[model samples]
Target chain A: MKTFPILLKTELKLSLRGMDMLIFALCMPVVMVLILGAVFGDRPAYDGASHTFLAQSFGAVSAIAICAGGVMGLPLVLSDYRGKKILKRFWVTPTSPAMLIAVQLTIYALYAFASLALVSLTATLLFGMRLAGSPIAFLGAYLLVMVSMFSIGALVGGLARDGKMAGALASILYFPMLVFSGATLPYEVMPPLMQRIADALPLTQGIKLLKAASLGLPAEGVALPIAVMAILALVCGGVALRFFRWE
Target chain B: MEYIVEAQGLRKTYGAVQALRGVSLRVQRGEVVGVLGANGAGKSTLIECILGVRKPDAGEIRLLGMHPERERKRLFAQVGVQFQQSAVQERIRVGELCQMTAALYPQTTPAAPLLAQFGLAGKLRQQVSDLSGGERQKLFIVLALLPMPQLVFLDELTTGLDARARRDVWQCLKQQKAQGLTIVLTSHFMDEVEALCDRVLILRHGQTHFEGTVQQAVAATPHQRLEDAYLWLTDDEREDNA
Candidate 1:
């Protein structure tokens, strides 16, 4: 229990002291929110929905930070540790792999929560958008999506041996989620066939749950998305634990 | 006296290369054993097997009368290890590294005293990246002794150190040995083996060609220097390559 906090502090220090991953994780999503939100501010979607483009886009855009941190950032960090034999050093010590993984999850979760606060506050104060759903429900949905996406990151990062391989796997997971899961491309605008495929994506279910929660929609139809998210969380989490190579 | 480490008929193979083949040896308590081998010899593999990082295909290994592979956590808590080229995390400060290492041991000595003993008290705040090669190696040695472990594994611990720094580490090892700690060290430098190890194991082609004191190993060859004797031992294999 005590080791987790020490490891988390070390990881956070590592992230902040280093420029590359921190810049990408903290600044990239915020930059995207500002740029995309500015260009499409208050414009109606093609379907003439009641919500402004800025509001809808920003709500969906918040999901991008989760995706980037988990799918892109997490895997690379895991793989680099493996390649550099960092985990090997820990293997000879009392530190368990579970402890290491728990630390990583905690650090990323902290970042995810920070990102949410930043994005939501910015959208509300600067863009005149209102949060539509129960705050508790929205918070619950965000945590679930973060867990599901981090599982994917851990699986890719733990299994891959090098940064290049991890990066490639991350791209395969990130691009589809960014484009098809309604973060960058609204699901309503996609072709019907593409929509069906998007429905199968982990992030698609995640975004669906998020949107449904934020819009105050009933939880009845949201059951499928929740189930998918749970499955993704379980399966990826299990595989990552099983196949992780320390060195 | 009871042996601190004992292994028999250890065998391991990686793809086409045979790392250890029927290799066996024993080290008594408080003995400082040096593993001397050519680059391709199974020294590292043997150390890995002893550390329980690599499972042997055919062998019985006992460290302090317990099987290391089956009881890894228990064995690890009592053993200290300094690996090859372990100074890659250069951005971390020496003091922080020491503190982090101390957390893993149930009973750990304070870092300040250890640093002071190593003449590194002034460099505790220096980043690992800024340290000289010898200082970095010394830092690893300090970490290895953080727990005051019963059995310590120093794999090439003095590889890149200068003569003075290498002598400093050897003195520390001698002090530790005098206090009844068992030491198992591996090094390619023949002089290091001569200076520190009480007994040396010469590994060739994944087998122990010689197992005796450094003087005995030296006496076995007609040549004077241990380096010459070592060359003589591996000369046949080099000819086979030619």
Candidate 2:
């Protein structure tokens, strides 16, 4: 465990040098929040909703960073390490592969929460957007969504034979979730068929849980979404663990 | 005999390909042992099994008097290895990689003096990707030696090096051997094995074809160079099998 801090420091330094994850996971979501807040500041979110558009979309928009980091950034880095034999190098040392994976997850989780905090601060200061739900419940939903998204990345990274394959798989999962999961485009504006399609996506269910927690709405009918996110997290994470190739 | 490594009846198969077949060898303390083999001759498989990186299909192996599979962590703390294809993160600086690796072992040689000894003092702040291939290989050797380990394993340690860089690495290995470090190395360069190894083991078709001192191996094919002797030994086995 003593090696954890050294490894984390090295990981953070390496992450800073790369900066691609920083731009995509940390900077992009803040930019989105600012743009969405400025352009549609006071528009009503839906026919019967009392919140403005930015307020309604806040939960989903916050998840954009998670998706970027978890689906795109995480897999690319892990697969690159495997391709370069970095994990195999560590396997011979006192530090094991399990420790490396744990450290990576911890680093991405830090990025996700940092992105969340930045988005929340920017939204509140720029547009007076505030969460209406229990802070504890909102945090719980945020963690669940983050874990579910990262699990998908782990599955791709753990199974991919190389970086190219991981990148291809990550993109296939990333773009669609960003556009159709009600994270970028509001779910209320989608056609009936699109809504049904979006409902089938893990991120869509994650956004629903997030929106309820953020709006302080009773999670009366959200049991299914919660269960879906939980199941996705478990199954994907389990598969990733079972099939992870250290070399 | 104070054997640093001992293996018996080591058999390993990857699907239908037999990577190792009943290979056994031993190395005493302070001995420099060179493992020589042609491509796919099970030198790597033998090393991996002994290092506890891979399990043999049927064998018993011990490192430093303890079973490697059962005492991997304990064994790794005392043994350092430089794999043929292993790499550090490209963006990491030289000093940082050294420091991180040093943190893994209970005892370590300080990074600064060691880097200077290897002619890498000025490259401490340089990223790994920025270094030349020889410099990177030297850095890997430095890492493998940093733990002050009782034994070290180096695979193709100077494969792509210029003569000067190769000599530099050879000098460092000689210094370590002089300090009573038991070294196990694999190299395609026959002269490297002759210059550095006290004893040489040649593997052919996943079996031990020859195991003896460099002089004994050379004398076996009298009036021939070590490289020719090596080829003659392996080629003789190939002919016998045919």
Candidate 3:
């Protein structure tokens, strides 16, 4: 427990002091939200509500940060540490590999929360959008999505050989989730076949589950998506931990 | 006196390459021993086996009278180590690194005194990346000595240092040895071994060909020099490779 906080502090300091990862974690998400919000402004989503696009899309934007940092950002960082022998150096110390992993998860969760807050603030103030569903539900959905995305990232980062490989793997997962998962393009607008493929993606289910929460809709239909997200979270998270390779 | 480090009939292989082949050696308490070897002579493998970093394929290893592989963590605390190229995060300050590493141990001396003693008192706040090679080496030595360990392993600790820095490190080692710490080190510098090692072991092809005082090792060679003796020990090794 103590090791987690210590390592988290060190990681956070490193993240802040370094420019590249900081831009990837903080700058890119804010830029994406602003650009997407501006370009998509005044355009109505599939629903006729003028402001529906902002509210729902804002949730997607938050999810983007979670996916980008947790899925892509974190694994590269962890793999880089391993490849550079930083993790190997720690192996000689009293610190266990498990503690190092815990620290990474903690820092990523913090980034997720920070991104969520920023996106929510931008949508509410700049776009004059209101969340349709219960705030508690929104919070719950956001946390679940963050955890699911982070687990996937951890699995990839742990299994990859180096930073380049981790970055490639993360990109393979991220772009599809961003584009085809109904985060950027609404699910109903996509072809039926594409919709089926999106349905198979964890991000698509995550977005649907989040949209249900933000729209105040009954979650009875969301059981399937939620179940899928939960299962992906478990299986990927377990495999990541079990087969995690540290240099 | 009981041997602080003992290995018997040790053997290790990585795929087709045999790193250690029935190699055996022993170091008694408070002895400053040096392992002189050419590239691929298995000095590092022998040290790693003793440190529990690598397990021997055959035979046994004992450090401080306990099995190293099974009791790694407990033995690690009792031993101090400086590897070939130790590196911490570039942005991490020396003081912070010292503090962090010190916290990992159950008992530790304060970093302030160690820094001052190593002539790094002014560079406590300086990031590790900014430090010169000698300063980094001194920092590592300070970290290794923080626990007042009974046995210290230094692998080519003076590799990149200038003559003055090398002498400083040797002096520090001598002082530390006077305080009753057993030192085991590997060095390519013949003068370093002659100046410091109470006994020198020449390793070639993962076996000890010569083990005695510096004078005896030098006297055994036709050329009567540490370098010549090292070459002589590995002459058969070169022929076998050819």
Q: What are the interface RMSDs of all the models? A: 1.8, 1.3, 2.0
Query: Which candidate number maximizes DockQ?
Result: 2
Give the docking tier of candidate 1: acceptable
Query: Per-prediction DockQ, in order?
Result: 0.46, 0.73, 0.42
Regions of candidate 2 where Cα sits further than 4 Å from its true position: B236-242
Model 3: per-residue Cα lDDT over A1-247, one tens digit each: 3545566677678766766555655666677667766877756665666446666566666676677677777788888878776776555555555676777788778877877777777777777678878999889988888878888988999999888888888889878887888766767678999999998888988888888888788879789877887888899899988998877
Question: Comparing candidate 2 with candidate 3, which one achieves the higher DockQ?
Answer: 2
Instruction: Name the lDDT of candidate 1.
Output: 0.80
Q: For candidate 3, what is the DockQ? A: 0.42
- Candidate 3 TM-score for chain A: 0.87
Ranking, TM-score, top scorer first: 2, 1, 3
2 versus 3: better lDDT goes to: 2
Supply candidate 2's per-residue lDDT for B72: 68
Q: Write the candidate numbers in order of decreasing lDDT.
A: 2, 1, 3
Error of 2 at B101 (Å): 1.1
Cα lDDT for residue A44, candidate 1 = 62
How well does candidate 3 score on lDDT at residue A232?
80
Q: Per-residue lDDT for A91-163 in model 2, tens only?
A: 6776687777888888889888998999999999989987778889999999999999999999999999999
